[model samples]
Target: MITAEKIFKSFGTCTVLNGINLAIGAGSTIGLAGPSGSGKSTLLRCIQGLESPDSGRISREGYPGFMFQDFQLFPHMTVWDNILYAPRVRKLFPRAYLEAKADRLLRHLAIGQCKDRYPTNLSGGQKQRVALARTLILGPDILLCDEPTSGLDVAATGDVVALLKSIQNEETTIVVASHNLDFLVQISNRIILLKNGSIGADIVPQELEDPIVHLRGLCD
Candidate 1:
C-alpha cells in the first residue's frame, strides 16, 4: 500500500500540493484527474521520489516505476538498449538475464519488431509501449504514469489503455494522471478529482452515471 500524509510542495514561491493526504490500496488502478497546474504531475513525481515535497511524509512498501508524459526514451539508443539501460546501470541482474527480460517485455508489448529501431522511428503508441516496457523491466510494485496518452489518437489511446489494463493484477498498483476522462473511466476503478492542489472528490467510476459531468462540477 502507498500512503501520503499532509503532503505539501512548492516551487520557489508558487505552491503546488497543499496539505494533500491519500491512501492507495494495493492492486488498485487510480486515476488522478485535474486541470493543468493542479499538481497532478508534481504529486506523481513526489511519489516516485523524483521530486521531494516541502513537507509531509510519503510511505510505500516498495519503489515505483514512473512513465513520463514525454516518453523519456534515450534518443541515441535503440529500443532494446533503452529497455536495458536501468538494469545495466544498477547491475540488478546479469546481462543475459536482462536481455531475456527485455525480449519478453518487448514481445508482450507487441513491439518486438522495433527492438533495433530508435525512438525517432516509432509511432506515438509504440514509443509509449517501449517506455512502459522499460519501466516494467524493473518489476516495480507500483506504476505511476503522467499523461500516458496525452498526444495519441483514439486508436492509440485504446491501445495504451489496453496495455495498462493487461498488466494490472493482484500485485501491482497503478496510478495514472491524465486529462482523458473517458479513458480513465474505462480503465481505472477509482477516480480522484483534484482542485487547487487538493482532492475535491474520491469516487468509484462505476458509481457515477456521468463522470465527465461530475468532474466538471468539481473543477468548476
Candidate 2:
C-alpha cells in the first residue's frame, strides 16, 4: 500500500507536480496518463525517491521494485549478475535463496538462456526482459514502471503485459506512468489522468466508452 498527499514539486522555472494526492491498494494497477510534459514521469521519480518532492508526504508500506523508462543495464555485467545485484546488495535473504529466486525469475521471464550473456549481446527485447527479471528477483512489494513497454515489437509488448499481470496476481501492486494510452488501457485496472501537473480524472474499469478520450479532455 502507498499514500501520497498534497505533493508539490517544480524544476526551477516550471511547476511539474502541483498538489498531487493518490493512494494505491495492494495488487492494484494504476495507470498514469498525460501529455508529454504533464509530470507523470516526474511523479514516478518522486515516488521511487529518485526525485525529492518539494512538499507532501509519500508514505510507502514496503519496499518497491522500479523499472526505469529505459532499461538501465550494465553493459559489462552478465545477465546473472544484473539479476543478482539487489538481494545480494541488501543482504535481505540467504545467498542460496537469492540465487534460487534469480534463477527462477530468469527462467519464468524466458531469459534464462541469456544469463551468461552481456547486455550488449542481447537484443532490445531481451534486454528489457532481463531488466524485468532482475527487478522481480528483488521480490518487491510494489512495482513502479515508467513506460514499461515503450520499446520493442508488438509481440514483445504482449509478453511484458502478461508478465506484469502475473506479477500483480502475485500481489505486487503496480503503478505504470506512460503516454501510451492504448497500452495503458490494455493493461491497467484504473486510469488517472494528469493535467497541468494535477490529477483531473480517475476512472475505474466500468467507466465510460473510452478512458483515453476522457483523459485527453483534461488537457483541454
Candidate 3:
C-alpha cells in the first residue's frame, strides 16, 4: 500500500503539488490524468523519491520501479544488453536467471525478434517495450510509468495497453501518469484527475456510466 498526506512541492516559485493526500492499495492500477503542468509527473517522481516534497509524508510498502517518459534505453547497447544491464550491475540475480527472465519478458512483450537490435534501430513502441522489460526484470512490487503512450500510433498504443494488462498481477501495483484519458480508462481501475496542483476528482471507472465523459466533466 501507498499513502500520502498533505503533500506539497515547488520549484523555486512555481508550486506543483499542493497539499495533496491520497492512498493506493496493493495490486491496484491507478491512472493520474491532467493537462500539461497538472503535477502528474511530479507526483510520480515524489512517490519514487526522485523528488522530495517540501511538506507532508508518503509511505510505500514495497520497492518502486520507475519508467521515465523518454523510454531511456541505452543507445550504445543492444536490446538484450539494455534489459540485463541493471540487474547485472547490482548483482541482484545470477546471469542465467537474468538472461532467462529477459528472454521471457521480451517474448511476452512481442519484442523477442529485436533482442539483438540497438535502440537506434528499433521503433518507438519497441523501445518502450525494452524499457518495460528492463524495469520488470528487477521484479519490483510497484511500477510507475510516465506518459507511457506518448509517441505511438493507435496499433502500438493498443499493444501497450494489452501488454500492461497481461503483466498485471495481484502482487504488483501499477501507476500510470498520462494526459490521454482513453488510454488510462482502458488500463486503470481507478482514475485520479488533477488540476492546478490539486486533485480535481478521484473516480472508480467501473462505478461511472462513462468514465471518460465523467473525467472530462461533460455530464452534470
What is the C-alpha local distance difference test score of each model? 0.89, 0.83, 0.89
lDDT (tens digit, per residue) of candidate 2 on 174-217: 89987777778878889888889889788884467877677667
Each candidate structure's count of clashing pairs: 0, 0, 0
Q: Which residue pairs show backbone clashes in model 1?
A: none
Model 3, 1-220: lDDT tens digits are 8899999999999989999999999999999998888899899999999999999999998989999888888899999999999999999998888899898888777889999999999998889878888888998899999988887778777877887898788878899998788899999989998888888999999898889988887212
Residue 201, model 3, lDDT: 92
Q: Model 1 segments beyond 4 Å from truth?
A: 93-101, 107-110
Q: TM-scores across all candidates?
A: 0.91, 0.89, 0.93
Angstrom error at residue 215, model 3:
1.1
> Over the stretch 120-218, how does candidate 1's per-residue lDDT look in tens digits?
999988898888889988988899989888777887677777778888988899999999899999889899988888999999989878987888788
Off by over 4 Å in 3: 218-220
